[model samples]
Structure formats: structure tokens, C-alpha cells
Target chain A: MSGLKNGILVAALLALGACTGNPWDDAAGVGGPGAAGLGAGSALDPQSPAYFQQEVGDRVLFAVDQSSLSEAAKSTLVGQARWLTANPDFIVTIQGHADEQGTREYNLALGARRANAAREFLISQGIAGSRLKVVSFGKERPVEICSNEACYAQNRRAVTVLAGGLTG
Target chain B: MRTYLASLAIGAALVGAAFMATAQTAAAQDGPLRIEITDGVIEPLPYAVPDFVAETPAAAELAREMSRVIAADLSGTGLFREIPASAQIAKINNFDAPISFPDWKAINAQALITGGLSVNGNRVTVRFRGYDVFAERELGTGLQFSGTTDGWRRMAHKVADVIYSRITGESGYFDSRVVFVSESGPKNDRRKRLAIMDYDGANVQYLTNSAAIVLAPRFSPTGDRVLYTSYESGVPQIYVLDVGSVQRRVLSTDEGIMSFAPRFAPDGRTVVYSQAQGGNTDIYTLNIETGQRQRLTSAPSIETAPSFSPDGRQIVFESDRSGAPQLYVMAATGGEARRISFGSGRYGTPVWSPRGDLVAFTKQNKGRFHIGVMRLDGSEERLLTASFLDEGPTWSPNGRVIMFTRETRGENGRALLYSVDISGRNLKPVRTPDGASDPAWSPLQK
Candidate 1:
């Protein structure tokens, strides 16, 4: 009976796969409405979330599983902080991610530490604490799906996403 | 061996008229009949379970299905082998047929199980008896179970449990459930939701949608509630979800704090998890009823993944205070901690077994991950599996097997659930729709 069920499931998956688009291409940009720019709008305003994500760089990569910011990561966060301060109408959430190297719970904790580290730096640079929220996806979501160190380095990252709405 | 005499009382009502004595019965009365399984390497005991006799026309198909389920449950344990019905020389068409002992013993069948089923309206009843072919006598008294038709599978499991316990002197794990993270979409932006299913990967039910990311769901001692970390509030906070109603409330209600890796204590009323404050992570406990909280660890470094001992006297957790992630043992109240892992690799996610003897964890060394077990003091460490990524192990109800997540590396890397025996044999994959990770096995069914 299990074999019969598995056979049907495989057939259904094959049928679905034929019509589905590449998931990686669809998930390339940052999350949220205007930030994704997938099908939201074609116009690129100087102050739009898409412009901030594409032009100002929405993410910063970390080393392995360490949450401590390196020189290059700090430089990227400085640019992100500057962009957020200029675009005062937008609220941002920092999404922390880790490479698939550690355990699930540990990666979650490590991701939290990384996001909090970035949030503190943004706050130190005079961003309001309420404007910046934090969440950690751990290793559940990875941009580069390879196992080698090259792809893992890209997976360990924290992205700042614009809320794209008016907020006090 | 201890036998249930009450089973004899039940047998008198169900098996007396059907009891069959053969020519070897006189010789069987002079010797004891039993089978004991103590080592890993041994031939599985051979048993026969003919299709049950259906008493009513409405029970014809159900009787056969239930018999198949019971056979699969026993054989899947790798401790028993079922002889195909084609090898049978006799057919049991009546519930109370007289002796046919020679027919079964001819096939070298050491054990034989015979049963009958009856369905009346919405209620179903199954009666079964086990026989020792070598002894040429009934192994145990007959037993019967009556339940609603919807619980037919459970009734089959109950029969298998009885047979397993009577023969091996160990409890059965067939009647349990596992909660895990069901993954879909692409690897870069996977959508995860909590799902529950039978131990054999049947009857799956989703507990939550994939609108928000959820992780590390731990079942309560009674299996009524689950403790997990969700990002629904824009930050990771511990949430307690009721399994029956699909309703949930945030347990880590503290403002401006992120909590993850929540686990229920043996008492089920309290929870222990990690909370990050001021860029520092530490372990904390909360009472679900009173809302009281206690700080369990205050190290400057990170400490998380806290699991309680069966007696609730101690907690085994992972900490990086020693310059690397390692296992630690500390009292429940929190004080000085003793490091338990000194191996070459980094270790995390130390879960204490229900039997209170070994701790299962994931170790990383030489760029390879492994699922391994160790004694309470961290001595006698044994690695069970090695792969690109293997982590987050949960023990079977009997503590004989360990289930963990394994992910293949590449552009199409995906996470899947796998299990292995603690003795490092019988490693196998657990089936699920799409991808799965972070499995939490539930206690035996009610």
C-alpha cells in the first residue's frame, strides 16, 4: 500500500514540476512588497524599497557560523545604515540567516546573535530601536545551495528589508 | 517470565471452544516455551499470521487489512519474520477451528497468531491468540479489543504490542507519532510548517500554515501541546500550541527579547529555552501556568538546546563557553556547570534519552557531521552516522532508535528525515511529502 501511495505521489510531483518556474530565480531578491519587485511595480523610484535593495545593497555576509562582524561586513552595514537614515519614511526588519553547517537550534541561536549584532550597530549609529526588528531563519533558507565553503559563505548573511509603509 | 493471568480469564470466554490440542501436547507439557532477544546479530524469529476470519460481511475487508497492519508492525522492528500465506498448508475459515498444530510446525514456524474480527454498526472488535508451535500449546491467553471503526489501526497496534512484549520482554514503539518541520519551495527561501504523522509516515496532518517560519517543535509529556519557536511577531518567540484545536499563544511574551530552542520539562508544565538579550544568549525556564520564569544559565557565551533528564533533576545542554560548542551537565536550578564533551569535534543538541542512560547529539569534525551517543559523563562516545549534514536527533519512546535530519549538499540540496538504531544498525529514511527536518517523537498513544 505504501508503495502504491508513493507511486501516485511521484506522478503528481512530476506533473507539477513541468509547469513550475525556477524557485531560485523567484526567491533571489529581498522579501516584502516593494522590496521584492517581482511583480509589484516596474517603476524604480530613488526612494523606493526596490532601489534601496538593488542599489544600496540590502544584505551583508558573515564568516562561517560566527556572528561577529568582519571588516567587510561592517562596511556593508555602514552603507545600509546610511540608506535607512536617508529614507526615514521606511521601517526595516533585519532577517538573519546561517549556513548549513551546525545544528538547527544552534544555527537559530547563532543567527539571532548575528542579527542582534547588526541591530545594535545600526542603533549605535542613531537608528531608532523600534524601526529595526529582527528575526532569524537559521539554516532553513539558504541562497547558495552548494555544500562547499564558497557557497556556505554566501548563505551566512543578514538582510535588511524595507517595510514599505508609513510608520511612526 | 511474568504472565498476565487475567488474560486466561478472557481466554476462557473466547478460546475454550476453539482450543486445539495436538499429538505433541503431552511432550509440550514437560518443557518451557519462550524466545529471548538479547544481541544485535541473530536470526529474526519466524511467525505466521493468517488472514483473520471475519464474522460479519461488513468486516471482511477490515479483518484482512488489520491483520496486514499487525504483521507489518512486528516485522518492521527487524526482530520478527512473517511467513507468507502462500506457504500455509491449512486455511483458518472458522474462528473456533480445532487443532491444526502439525500444519504450522511443518513449515518451521516457531510462533503462530490466529485472530477473528467482528463489526457491529460503528464498533469493531478483534480477538486474537498466540501459539508456540514447538511447545504445541497456546503461548498466552487470548485477548480482545473493541473500539470505533475509525480506530481499527490502533487496535492492530495493540495486538502487536502484546505479542512483542510477551516475547522480547521489551515495550513496543509502533503506536506513536512524530512532529517535524515540513519544507517546500526552493532551497534559498524554503517554506516550513509543522506536521504530525503516524510513526510509519501515515495519516499526516498539518498543524500550521507556512505564512511564518516555525522551528524545533517539542511535544509535551502528555502529547496534548507543543512548544516551538515562531517568527510570527517579526522576532523569534517561544509559542505553546494546543495540538487538538490548532490554537497557539506566545510563551516568551517578554518585550524586546528573542527566544528559541524551547523544550518541555518532564513535568510538562514548565519549559526551558534560550533567550538572547543584549547580544548575549542564555538559558531560561518558564512555567506555562503561573508565567513565572527562572534564569538557568548566565554565561557570556551562547548556551541553548536544553533538555531535561527523565527524573527532572538535571539538564543536559550545549554551551560555547569553553571556546567551542560542547555538551554540559548542570542541575535544574542552575549553578556551576561541568563540561561533559572533550572530543576533537564540536558537539551540540544533547538530548537525554527517556531511559536516562545515554545522551544523543550531533558532532562536527573534519568538515563532516555525525549523529552519535555517549554516556551521561560523556565517556564511551560512539558515532552512528556520518554525512554532509546530520543533526537534531530525537529518541524513540523505547530509546532504542534515534531519528535525525540529514541534508544532501549541492544546488538542489534538501533536508530529509532519517533514523538509526542506537547500536549503529538498521539506518533508514523516514518518508514525508517534500522535505522534512527537526523530528520530535511523541510518547506512546493513549
Candidate 2:
């Protein structure tokens, strides 16, 4: 069942890539298309961290004071789980975050819940629990700096940060 | 008038009477000089503190500085207004001289503080007195304190505490310390270090370096040790540090579990804190010496920020069992809890006042945050301040004042320590070397 889901996910990604002509175009927001300068091993490479972070979406956003995964967030996590399965040598740390709308202690716990939610989803997708670790930054780290819902929506997120290399 | 004269004679003869006894006598008289703090909309009692008399040449500067600190301490409460020396109708050149009632009354000074300072090599002695200027009598017995020259500020605070206690019939918070997380850098990558300072933000001493992230430094009941959460081990863990030695050790817990929001019980032997495991959080009490842990709350919702009541028999904490964070009170050992906050928005960081009658907390409502206080039964909820982000309130040793963190809005937002009276007045910023938050006030110094 898991293999069949991956096959269809890969087929959909390839069809989407063919339509865009450049698979790296969707990642322009990270730092333009070829910023990594890796050439053949650049963000254009499907297995690269840049591709996972940008094209496949490394982070899932949450609503204000919420930790339950949204449908959009689940879709992104499914892609993340597929990539993790393909790259078994990479150990990923799921970082949960919250907006500045809550207390310091509550936000810390909320961030943990969000990160755990993402971790559980990946585990359900057959990723080994040992290959994943979770941390909650709470509201300490934010990708954006505004005070409105726009910035808050971005801050309340769980990002899968990949660590270690293909040592195996 | 007869009772006032009799108490005045006792105050003069027993110059060393316990402050509580003297204050009680004055309070029993129901003198016009009393400032009823519970009464709303108080007109600040105008008072004067002329430069203390310098008996020795080396004491001149110290005398002047101490007098200024005393005046600042009294006026900072917003209950007392200092009448500047420039407006004083009389000069207090001699500490033992009879107070010129007519001169003080002419300047509308309702109360007066006069003192003398003497320095002998490294030793310094300060003697001070408070007077009901309009009554033409001393407010309390004169008192003297002796300490080393390096401890002049503490001696000054002692004087102010005595004056405050005498006038208001309540213990003073001036002679206390606060341990807090001092922050530097930007919003995302802030560097935090544990720092301790005088309650008035003087004599700051960094307890830890900014090498790791630290949050919520809480002072022990005796103020000699600090409890806080540090990420030095790559995860949140509770640590206790001796303020005098600056040495610390992590509290052992089940591996991989996160612990934060630690508070020392009044007995200083046990700590009530929040522990998270398996994506669920709950409150737990730990015996610091024995390493024994007891689960306090088994709710599926988040339960953290537990504060012990002054008597140590009860604990007040924040929980989201009702779907949004609110204040709840339970036995120190924990079981069933009664919700103490029924407000519209979320409430968190509930700190029981040292007085044990009120609990201070951070409230968020309608997109604005407030530092508020509510009674034990969840009645008489009063919001003291409103801002973009205001949370984590710590009470003064006296419980009359609350110090909390207030963060600005937007990209350049920074957290700063601010304080307000429980009556919702005299909101002011506490000076720090840089951005600061999560203030935990220590009990009055011994």
C-alpha cells in the first residue's frame, strides 16, 4: 500500500515538473533557482535538501493557538515522508514553532504538539521513529517578523530540518 | 491627641522598638496621616526627604545618594509623592533636631523623612526617622542600621523599607532581589543569560553566560538559589543554581522528557513545574534533594506554570483543560482543581501573590494582552495593563506590586521588564542592560 502511494506521488510530481519545464522554478523564493550553484547536484536535483525545503515544502503552517494538522499541512507532510523514505541516510529533526499570541510556557508546549503531529504523520507513512527527532522552539524563532495574522501564520509552523549526510 | 502623645513618648524612649509594634500603635490611632492603599483613586501623599545629615566627611556623598534612593523607593509606589529638596521650606541639618512642623506644613508636606549618616573607615551607620508632619509628631521610632561601606545601597533600602512599613502598615519590597532572563540580539536568535539585580534594577549581576537559551529564572524563597529552564543539553531541562557560588546542576528526569516553568515551593524543598512527554504536558512536583517526582495533574490538556501559594499548601497553575488556557488552583500535592479564571480570552502564568489573597496572571483578549489580578475564588478580576504582548507576572515580596514582561509589536519588538501596582497604577519600566523577560522576584532579604 505504501509503495503504491509513493508511485502515484512520484508520478504526480513528475507531471507537475514537466508542466513547469524547470522543477527548480517553484523554489525561487528560497534564493532564486540556481543559488546553491551545485550544478547537477543543485536544487534541480530531486533528492537535494533545497528541493525538499523549497519544491516539496519542508514546513507546515498552523492556525493561531492550534496544533492539529490542516489538510494543506498534511499534504506537505506526505511529500516530506515520501522524500525521507527515498533518502534513508538522512536523519530529520522536526522543529515545532508557535506565534507570539500565547504565553512562553504554553507556546513551548504548543510547539511540541505541532512538531509531534508532524512526526506522527511521518511515522504513519512508515518512516522509522529512530530516524526522526522533534524539538519545539515555541515562539522563539519566526521565519517572518510582522505582528499581524500574515506573520503569525508563518511563525506557527513545523519545519523538518535534515541533518547528517549519506554516510551509509 | 492624648494617645498620640503617649505613643510618641514610647517611640522616643524605645528607639529600638520592633517596627511592627510601632506601626501597629500608629495604625490603632487611625491617624489622619495613614494612606489607605485599598481605596481607589488615591491622591499621592506628598512627603519630603531632605539630604540626610552627613556626620563624617566621607559620608557626605553617601548620605546624599542614600536619601535620593529612599525618596525614589517611596515615590515609585505611586502612593507617595516626593516633595523635591528645592521646594523644602526647611533644611534638615541635624538628625536629632526637632522637626519644624510649621515649615513642613507651609510647604504642604504631609510626611517627612530625616536621617544622618556616619562612616568610620569601612563601616557605615545610617539612622533615620519618619514624621507625620501635619500631626507635629514622629510617625515611628527612629531606627539605625550598620553595615560595610560596600553595602551602602542595601542599607539605604533598609531605611526605605522601614519608612514604607511605618507609614503604610505593610511590609516593604525595597530590600529584595529579582532573578530574570536577560536577552540580547534579535527576536529570532536572542541570546539569554540569567541575571540578578536589586528589586529597583540596581547592582545587576549576571548569573550565567549567554552561551545557551535560558528562560523563566525563579528565585527560591530565601533568594540564595535560582530555578530556571536551560537548553544547554539540546533540550529543555530544569536546573538549580546557587546565586552566591554561581554553580548549577540539572535536575534529573526521565531521559528525553522536557521540563520548564519551575517554581520553588515556599518551603524551598520541593519544586512545582511542568513536564512534557509523548506530546502531552502536565504539572509535576519534584523533591529536589531526593529526586522523587509526583504527578500533580493528569489532564490531557497543557498544564504548566505552577506557582505555590505563600503557605505552600496550595498550588496555582495554568491549564487548557477548558480548551483555552486559564488559571486553576489545587492542593500542593494535586488532585482536583478549581478553575479561577472565567474571562473571555486566554489566561496564563498564574502567580499567587505572596500575600496569598490574589493571583496575578497574563490575559489575552481581543488581540491585546494584559497583566491582571483575580481573587482566589476567581472574582474581582482586574487587568492592570494592556499591550501587544504582556505575560509572566511575578509579585513583589509585599504582594502590593507586580513586575512582568511587556514585549513590543512588529519586527523590531523587544521584551522589557515592567511593573505596576495591583491597584492598576504607576506602570513603569524596570531598567536592564538589554532586553529582559520572565522576572521572578525574591522574598525580602534577611
Candidate 3:
């Protein structure tokens, strides 16, 4: 039942993306003569952080009380790894979070495990370990505030946040 | 925070000529005024505290306020009920006057408390006595206390503590404080600051600003220091703060590793906390003075929230070694642990009671969270509360009550502090200016 609902939600999001003129679909005709011009830092630009977040997906969700990565999560991480490699000047921090179903201390440890899993996968995909740092917010920070499983699924995620100027 | 009042001056000699003999022997004979707290249903012993007599003109308001505070401290315990002064047939106009036993019996007041207050410049003095109306004798020795006028509330609590101990035969928890994380803002972007307040949620003082996230503030054995986890360095690290000076320093736990759930040992010099490294979390003990470290548990699964028994002989903690979180007991020095929670649920955050009789914990079973207590052997588990989310149980000084954090469900959910007796009775919310969580009760003040 949830899978069917998720499919509908994804289809609706794609329809909205088409209306917004998603740049990934227009990238093939970009830079050609008389083609629509796109700014370098705009969300439509493939090399921008905005594009990485919207098109490539910066976050991956997890199951309840489990830190192991799923197949869909791996696919998202692959895109994240490629973006990180292409933009070598940016350093990323993997923020791991959990739902409000567990104790505070245990959730913290679980978040750490999730962030470390993402960090390890990125390293395996040819990204330097030095450019990747991990921090667990536990259940303290949630993207969705509802108490149902849909919100919890969105809250239990690891996001790759990029910052300019890599010190290392 | 209020100028740090001087230590209370306890009068040495007993007062009142009616103190013919020690009330301890009389109480031992099973008087009609006794209350057995372990009973299934308590009647709430009826007690009365008339407005204390003001010996000086300037002490009239202070006397009345102090009397109210004393009555509140006693009635808040859920074991006693305070009869209103309007219900009293005999008014105490003089502190030293002989009590009218028949008038008190007429109102069905089993216990009576009388007090006198005097003010001289910045110095204030209070004297109080407890009585058993049925026996027509004093319950305990009359006592006197002297302190600055700013400490009037604490003086009242001291008097209430004495009366409570004399009647219940157990130490009172009124003269203690609680350290917690004060929260504000919405659920998604909540801000947390370290805060300390009196046991009854009075005199709240913020120890740290909300610039950084802080969690699990714990008081030292002497209530002079607090240890908590902060993300000031962008990673969770334990920091110890002196309560009086408000000065803080982070304990050294290696860089780039997450350390949290810090708790002070009974000796006050050592700390036990969880450290996460390489995605594996384990428990470790660190000595504050020597910078020495000891690995208490090297389990592959999560092991955290370690608490020491009052005797400092054993430690109770939570671990997921059995594929799910459960309570475990091991020596304070470290070794093989014995699993103590056999029930059908996941358990974490086990805190040993100060009296060394039971361990309080948070259990999540069938989608509901509960605050529960169990015997040392894991037998006779009794849940005190059930809510959408309830965690982090901290014991009162006397081990008769447990305070925990309860968060409501939905987008507008917020955390609040709630306390309950060990018998699963008297559940009520503690008032805080903002949202609060992670409460740690301090030992009784010296």
C-alpha cells in the first residue's frame, strides 16, 4: 500500500518538475546556438550546488532503527559521489538524523552509524576521505514534523551538505 | 544567582517546653499519625500550616509567604494534603502557645505545624515545630534556622524537610535542585540551553546560552558541578561546568569522536560516558583530574547510558547486544554483564535509584513509550507512565519519585518535564518557562 502511494507521490513530483522546466532534461540542447541561456549558479545549471540538491539528490532515507544502506540509497549516493568528485573545491558534511521513536542517547548512536555508513560508501566511490566529515544530530533535527510513518521516513535520512573552501 | 546566600545557621538547642521526650520512640510505637507509602491507595494524611506568626512588623508578608511555601512542599509529595487555614478552628497567634488538641481534632487535622519569623536588617530567623494532634505531643524537636532575607524560600524548605522526615521516616527531597536542557523554538529548529532550577521548579537559572545544542545535564555528587554534551565544536563532546562560577571546560575525549551521555561517579572525580568511533559506540570512564581513560565495554553493539549504584560497587546500563536494547548490570570497574530486562520490549537509559533498591528506565513497546521501574533482578516491573514519547528518568534524592521528559505528538509537539511516584501515582507536569528535557536531580544541599 505504501509503495503504491510512494509511486504516485514520485509521479506527481516529476510532473511538477516538468512544469518548472527541469534543467537536466534541457541540458542536451544547452550552449547550442539560440538555445535557452542558463546562469552558472542557477538551479538549472548542472555544475551548481542547487542542481546537485534538486537533480542529483543530496539525501537518502533509511528504515526504522537500521543504518544499513538500501538499494535506492546506494543509487542516490552514487550521484552524490560523482558530484563531489566533479566539484573538488567543496567539502561536504554528512548530517545523519533519526525519527522520534527511540531514546535520546540510543538515537544519537544510531545516527552516528548512519552517517558513517554514508561516509564509507562515498570513500569507496573514489571521493577523498578527508573531504567528507560526519555529524549526528540524533532525533533533534527533523525535516518533517508529523508523527506518522511518512514523516518519520523523511526525517530518518543522511544529507550531504556542501561548504566552499576545503581546508584540508 | 540571587547573590549566593550564606550557609544557613542551624540553632543547636531544642526549643519549646512541650518537647518532654524524643518523638522517635513515640513514632516507633506505631502512632495513629503514621503513613505507609507502599500501600496501594493512600488517604493523604491531613495536615495544617496556619500562617506563621510575625514576631516583627516587617516580617508579616515574609511569614505568610514562607508558610505557604512550606505547605506546598509537603502537599506536593502526594502523601499529604494541606487543610486550608479557613478550615482550622484554632488559630496560632503566638508561636509558643500551647496547642488546643480538641480544636485540631475537630477539624480532623492529624498533623499540625507552627512557626515564627523575625527580621533584623538583612538577617532573618525562623523557628518551627511539628505536632501530632491525636497523641497531643510534638512529633519532633523544635528547630530554628537563620539566614539572609533572600534565602527565605530555602529556609521554608528546610523546615518542610524536617517535618517530612519526622513524619514519613524517609529523607526529604525538597532541599535539592535539578539540572536540565531548556528548549525553545519550533520542533524542527529547536534551541537548547543548559539550565538549573530548584526541585519544585523555582529559581531557574540558565547556565549556557542557546547558541549551541546541549543535552543531558547531570549534577555532581555534591551539586557543585554539571556535565553535559555540547556541539560547540561541531561534534558532540562532554563539557563540565561549575554551578557557582558558571565556568566550563570540555573534557578531553580525543578529537573527531562523538562523546555524550556523561554521568559523574559517586566520587565526583570520575565520569562514565559513551564514545562513538568508526560507527561503533561503546562505554568508557574518564578521570577528570588525571586525564586517564578506561574502556568499560567494547561490545560490537551499542552500549551507553551507564549509571552507578549509590554504593559505587556496580553499574547499570543499556545495551543492544541481544539484538535489541535492554538493561544490563555489571561491576563499576568493568567486566561481563548480566542482562536484567527479560520483558518483551526495548529498554534504554537505566538509572539506579539513590536508595539502591530499584532501577528506573525508558521502555518502548508496541509503538508506545513508557517510564518504568524494576527491581535489581529485573522482577516486578511497574510502568509509571505511557505517552507518545517519554524518556530519560531521573530519581529524586529520596528515590520515591522519578522525573522524565514527555513529548507530545504532531507538528506542534514539544517536550515537557513530568514526575511520578514509584507506585505509579501522582503523575503531574513540572512548570518551566519554555520546553524542557533531560532532567537530572541533585543530591540534597549541604
Candidate 4:
């Protein structure tokens, strides 16, 4: 039964890979073992935003003061793009956040860059730009509220939140 | 010890000369023994502020309250030590009563302040005189302030500013306001709104509701308008607010760009802020009246947190163009920039001091954040406060002190406001109704 679930998830992700124009681009990590594990949960409940938030993973982390997406971030965003493509009825706002390491205004700008990066990537993956809006909370809101590196890593992220509407 | 001059028996003229010589030496030896300290750190001068004499029944409570505030203002500076009422050796019953210098001297009080108050219906008057008790003379001219009863605290602050300026040789920062972000809610989803209060964190008035997130509230040169970034429209945009009527309008709404970290030029007509476009952020200035816009920095690297010098001829800002964030200065019109900070750490939030002598900034070095200052030439850098998370520094109006936000680390962490002197003394937490950050001190009240 597990093998069948893994097969189905791999097939779906490989279909997503076919949407891309370049085969040499292994940056998305499509059809990998990670995809099988992510398929274990209720992959996509078309009716539930909670399923999209919890199962699809709402956020992606970035390196210190960086808005560029890492390979791991790209892989997670691939999953997000797939889910967002499936749930076209939902409009999402991507909130970019930063660690407490930089100044307030700089962090705000960095957050904006991060959110834009995420928004642009989602759009590239066939999600409509109008469906994805972006806002930057800067260092104002931190998921992990510690000053040390462990927490800073988690705090530097861009999160996609569903505004919850069937029609925009 | 007395000096005796050797005199000839040439007459009374010679005798008089000898007497005058002896008297001159005696006067030199016994003169007022006053300490004229021009500068440098010394013990806080001890002073006494007896309750102000109330000339009418309506003034009784306000008189005491005014004196209390005056004492708090002086003592709060950490430059003057208030001799408590318990330590008072004598009290002045009349506003014009002679100061008992001997009593003050006996108690080691270096200065004394005597005040009188009168209230009739809606009007109030405060008369105050500062005395250099040891020198046995009134220090500076006695002054009186008149205002409505509702504005009694402002009158008290003005009186204190007068006294503080007379003694400290620098202008006072007590009669100023601070605009900051008030925060609440859980860590992951905190809410922030723009709020303004006195320099001492009193008279808090919320300028914007918390329905949307706001960051970096800055005061206009005249303190009549506030510039802040709000996410009310689901995107970060700058909004200018009239502080008096609470009316607000979007300052800039360039298509598909995020603008934040705004500051008013010294002239108050133009504003400088950071706007992010196509994943690139830079600084821009806008004329409020004519709606003219100018791009200050076009670097691919991020450039934000721009502050104008008091003279408005130049601007100091933080940029990551040097690979790591560092302080830089450029002409107000924007051109080639000269790097100002060569330190080993990341430097940001460079706010030029109103005095034009130093720029206060936040530095992150070796896993610690600090609030620090440096001269305009990028020399004499001094870190004032060090902690896990200390950022967003704003200069006091007189440029004697700085207030910034410091956040603690944990799952339940929160941000608090703090102020410290430029001399790196008297670090105190500013009292707020809730968590606060991004403090911008307003110019001295008119």
C-alpha cells in the first residue's frame, strides 16, 4: 500500500516536472525520494485551506540577509507551487519576514525582496500573479523568537497565507 | 595664611599700597571656592527643589505636581542628584524669600530651585528661579510661564528646560515627543501601530489603529506630521499622518513597489525613503507639495535607512554594496558615495545626530547586536549598549541621548524601548503601555 502511494505521488510530481522547459535543471528536486515522503499525508483536499497550509508547508526559509532561494527552498517551493496550482480558487498573501540580525528598515526591504522572490517563482510555475500578493512584516514578526542562530534561521522566511475566497 | 608686604616709611600712600597688597592676597585666598567644571564626567550636582509655594487654593495640588515633575526632569538626566524632601535643611515659604545659603551648604546642596504657582479659573502661571547656593547668587534670570490649566505639565517641562539649559550649557531635550511602534499579540503574529508620546514616555496617543502592520514611524521637522509604512493595503506603503487631527494620506503609491523606512529632510518639505522594485531596493526622495520624485541610489545592492544631516546638505545611510552592510554618506542630490564605516561588523540604521557631530547606528558583531555612535568622518565609534537584539536608534532632539528597541530571545520574546546618553551612561528602559519599537524623537516643542 505504501509503495502504491509513493508511486502515485512520484507520478504527480514527475508530471509537474514535465511542465518545466529544461531537463538539466535539477534545482527543483522533482520525483525525488522527498516527494514520496511528502505524499504520505492527505496530499490535497481541494476544499480545505488548512490542508494546504499544514500539508503543503506554508513557509520557506532563506539564508542570512539573502532573498535568493536555496535548493532546499526551491524544492519546498516546488511543492507549494503544485499545491497552489491545484487550488486555483484560493488567493494567498505571501508575508516575508526576517531575523532579528539586521536593522529594522533594511530588514523590511530584505523581507520585501524575499516575498517578491517567492511570488515571482510561484508565478513562473503557472500560478497567476493576481492570485499571489506579497507583504513584508520585516523583523516585526518572528516565528522563532530567539536572538541566537538556531532561532534566526527559522525566523528568516517567507510564508504564504490563504485569504480564503473561492473567487477573487 | 595672610601676606604682609614689606613697606617703606615713605607716607600714608606707601602704607595704603601695602594694605592693598595684603588685601588682594587675602581676597585671592578666601574667594568663593566654587568649582567651575567645564566638561568631563563628574559626580552629579546635588540640588534641592522644595514644593512650589501655592499662591491660591486652586494651585495647591498643581503646584506640588509641577515641582515634582521639575525634580524628575532634572534628576532623570543623571547629571543632577535631587536631595529628597527628607534631606531638606530649610524650605522657602515665599517665592522671594532669601535663600538660606548656609543651610544648603551645611547639607552639601550645590544648587537650589524655588518656584511659585498661581491658578485662576483656566489660566495657570509658574515662576521659577534657580540658585547656585554655594556661590550665593541666583544662577541665570528667573523666568515665568503662563498657560491653560490643561497644559500645566508642558509649562512645567518648559520651566525645567530653562533650568536644565542654564546649568548644563546644552539645550534641553525634555520638552520633546517620540513616535514609536506599539506592539502586542504573540510572537509569530505580532501587531504594530504608530503611537506618539512625550520624550519621557508620557501622554501616549495612538496615531494609527492596529488593523494593519506599521513599521518605522518618523517625525517631520516641525513635529506636525508623521511618516510611517503601513500594510493596510496588503502591501507596504508609506503614509503621512497629520498628528493633530489624525488624518492621513498615502505619501507614495508607485505601482507595484514597497516603500518603507522614510524620513523627513531638515526642511520638512521633502522626504527620503526606501522603495523596493523588481527585487531591488534603493533610496528615493519626494517633494510633498509638488509631487516631484528623485531617485537617490540606483545600486543593485540594497540601500535604505537614509537620514539627512541637520544642515540637509548631506545624507547618511546604510548599504550592503560593500558586500556587507556599512555606513555611507552622499550628497543630498545623490551621487558617488564614500564609505564611512570600516569596522569588522555589519553597521546599519545610521541616524545623524541633530548636533551634526555623531551618527548613531546599530552594529552586529560576533553574534551580538549593539547600539553605537561614530563621528561623521567615520571615526571615534563608540558602542553605547550591547545585548542580543538592539537595533533601530533615534536621536534625542538635543542629540544628547538615543532611544532604540531591544528584544530578548526566547519563544515568548518581546521588544522594549530603551534610551542612553551619548556619554554611555544612564541606560534606562522607557516605560510603555505595551511592547514598543522604532522610536523617532521629535524636534523640541515650540
Q: lDDT scores for all predictions?
A: 0.80, 0.83, 0.85, 0.80
Once fitted onto the true fold, the runs of candidate 3 whose alpha carbons sit more than 4 angstroms away are A1-43, A166-168, B1-21, B24-32
- The TM-scores of all predictions, comma-separated, are 0.86, 0.89, 0.89, 0.85
Report clash pairs, candidate 2. none
Alpha-carbon runs more than 4 Å astray in model 2: A1-45, A166-168, B1-32
lDDT of 3 at A128: 94
Clashing pairs in 4: none
TM-score, cand. 1 vs. native: 0.86
lDDT assessment of candidate 3: 0.85
Q: What is the C-alpha DockQ of each candidate?
A: 0.41, 0.32, 0.43, 0.38
Top candidate, metric DockQ = 3
- For model 1, state the Cα shift of residue B313 in Å: 1.1
RMSD of each: 7.7, 7.6, 7.9, 10.1
DockQ of 3: 0.43
With candidate 4 superimposed using the best TM-score fit, by how many Å does residue A152's alpha carbon deviate from the native? 2.9
**Best model per lDDT:** 3
- CA error at residue B423 for candidate 1, angstroms: 1.5
In candidate 1, which residue ranges exceed 4 Å CA deviation?
A: A1-48, A128-130, A164-168, B1-38
Tens-digit lDDT track for model 1 on A1-168?
Answer: 243543443344344432213111113343322333455545668576656665566777788768888887677778778878898877777877898888887887788778888888888888899898786777866656667786677678887867755431
